[model samples]
Target: MQLSPDEHIFWQYGFVKLNATIVFTWALMLVLAVGSKIITGKLATGLKRSRWQNLMEIVVVAMENQIAEVGLREPRRFLGFIGTLFLFVAIASLCTIIPGFKPPTGSLSTTVALALCVFVVVPLFGIEDQGLIGYFKSYLEPTVIMLPFNIIGEISRTLALSVRLFGNMMSGEMIIGILLTITPYIFPIVMTLLGLLTGMVQAYIFSVLATVYIAAAMGDQGLKQEPEAQQ
Candidate 1:
């Protein structure tokens, strides 16, 4: 049901709004991710097997494989970034299951913050991979003359990444929401299945791109080597 304009404003700007929900939900996801790791590790150590242990193992193994393939052989290095990103995004996407809840990714702020987090981590990883001096020099790539343009390109890409994800996921939600409003029964079911696919794909895209960003920040500039011009 479309809310009255006044109700919409209140829903958006009231004390408990999307911003608060996003922060709280992400904090909850962080806590759960950490708690799950600790509890499962202890349980696995104490007992031969447990249901939660097996389930969590599957999740960790899948995430490990993802990191191994996209983040190179050193999956341990990606524990914090991939773990946090995947957990937060996974939880955020699932929030739509509650009628009153909205997916945080539906807001530009959430997606922008996520992109900024990846952008910031990239530099930190780069500096870790290459010392500060070496990292700064990497902006020059094949030549120092390219440094300014490279820097600009990097900044623009972070913003573009944010916008791309924000636009796709948010628009998808809006379209589905509209369809549900228009037709009560059949349309919503189809929309729900479609959304399920979209949600998973968006999460995968986010995770893969985050790994790519990390690789770049870790001074794997070779990953972006330009091909020679065709003869």
Candidate 2:
């Protein structure tokens, strides 16, 4: 059985090569981009709304509420990043029902890329909320010796996020592949449904963790703003 989409090569030219991971990743992104355009192109303001518009509104509202619940003072500020992350992972899993389609998320590279996006954004959000000096100074909080540890914690968590997502997604694929070989057809079908549920759960967990990290990066400023928001 194929352990990773990276192993499936579709094209190669000396140092450059195209694999299943790259192909599917780009394909999925295109689908998301075009679908978003089509869904949002004719948005309705009146009482009469299309089902897709209603669904989109529901998802946006739900995501905003989730971000607020995670302690972000301005949910809309973080909605684009957080919502995109959730939708990508959730949609990738949902597409598994399609024949001959492999989720790019099952590959370590894709997960690492996703984690790196969060990694880079966290510091940016921090700097935006608390100027450059203030954000960097956060590492030296409470004492000077904690600086290295704080930096290490940031790097370590990014690694953990990537590995956790890759492992879970890959394992789900692995189990279904194994089941198809050793078990009957009906059993594998049941497992596939369970895997879809697990994928959605993983997407939620990943987005929540990212929001928590961003909220932490916002530091005391976020806390200070929270009360004002409540009032």
Candidate 3:
């Protein structure tokens, strides 16, 4: 059995090739884009609303509430970024039920890209909230000797994010594949349901961790300002 969606190549031109990961990822993005636009186009501000609109608003509000609970003061400011991350991962896993369809997240490249997005956004948001100097100054907190360690921690966490997602997704796919081979009927169906639950849980976890990181950045800035205010 193929270990990853990367193994399914659709096209090749010398050194360049298109694989299932790239194709499925783009397909997923397109669906999300078009679906969102369609759903939002007729958004009603009045008492009467479509069921789809209500459902969409519920999901969005729940996500925003979760972000606020995580310590982000203005959740809307971070909602777009964090919401997209959760939806992408959650949808990728949910779509696996389709026959012959594979989730791009089963590939290391996809997970790494997702993780790197988080890595980059962490500092960007921090800088936006704290100003460049103030954000960088966070590395010197408690002592300047912590600089290298802080830097290392950032890099290590990004790597961890990527590997954690990739391992969980790939292992799930592998387990399902093995079950299908050994007992082609009942067990695989049960496993598929469990996989869906696991996928959603993982999505929640990844999103929450990302929110924590962003909140920590802003929290550090708040802490730095507190002493000055007190003085």
Candidate 4:
């Protein structure tokens, strides 16, 4: 079984090569872009609205609520980043039902790219909210001795985020591939359904964790557990 879409090369020129991971990733992005444009084109504010508009509202509201629950007081500020992350991962998994499609998340390069985005954005959001000096001060929290550990924590968490996503997605694809070849029938169908569910869960988890990291960077006041800690 192919462990990743990177192995499926479509074209090559010396070191430069196009692979399935890049193709599918771009295809997914295009779908999201066109879908968003179409959905938002006729957004109605009156009593009457299309089902698609209603569905889009529901998704936005739900995502905003989740951001609030994660301790970001202003959900809309973070909605674009968090919502896109969730949608991309969730859609990648959902598309697995289509034959010959592989989720880019299954590839380490893709997962690392996603993780690095979070890694960079977390600090940017923190600095935006806290200022450069204030955000840097977070590294010196509790005591000066903890600075190295705090830095290490940030790096470690980024690595964890990438590996966690890559492992889960790659394993699911591997299992489904194996079953499809060996059994070729009822069991594969069941596994595919389970994989879809797992994909949704992973997408939720990845988004939630990213929000937590951002919240922590934003300061204790913006963390969900801050209230409990004070009490």
Question: Which is better, 1 or 2, measured by lDDT?
Answer: 2
Candidate 4 regions with alpha-carbon error over 4 angstroms? 220-231
Better of 2 and 3 by lDDT: 2
TM-score of 3: 0.92
Q: How many clashing pairs in candidate 3?
A: 0
lDDT for model 2, please.
Answer: 0.89
Best by TM-score: 4
Residue-level lDDT of model 4, residues 16-94, one tens digit each, is 9999999999999999899989999988999999999898899989999998887887788999999999999999999
The stretch of ten residues in a row with the least summed lDDT in candidate 1 is 222-231
Candidate 2 lDDT, tens digit per residue, 1-231? 788899899999997999999999899999999988999999999999999999999999999999988788889999999999999999999888888889988999899999999999999999999989999998998689999999899999999998988898899899989898899589889988998998899899889989888888886767434422210
Q: Which candidate do you rate higher for TM-score, 1 or 3?
A: 3
lDDT of 3 at 197: 92
What's the ranking of the predictions by TM-score, best on top? 4, 2, 3, 1
**For candidate 2, which ten residues in a row score worst on lDDT?**
222-231
User: Which has the better TM-score: candidate 2, or candidate 4?
Assistant: 4
lDDT of 3 by residue, 37-115 (tens): 9999999999999998998999999999988777777889899999999999999999989888798888998999999
**Position 6, candidate 1: lDDT:** 19
Question: What does candidate 4 score in Cα RMSD to the true structure?
Answer: 2.4
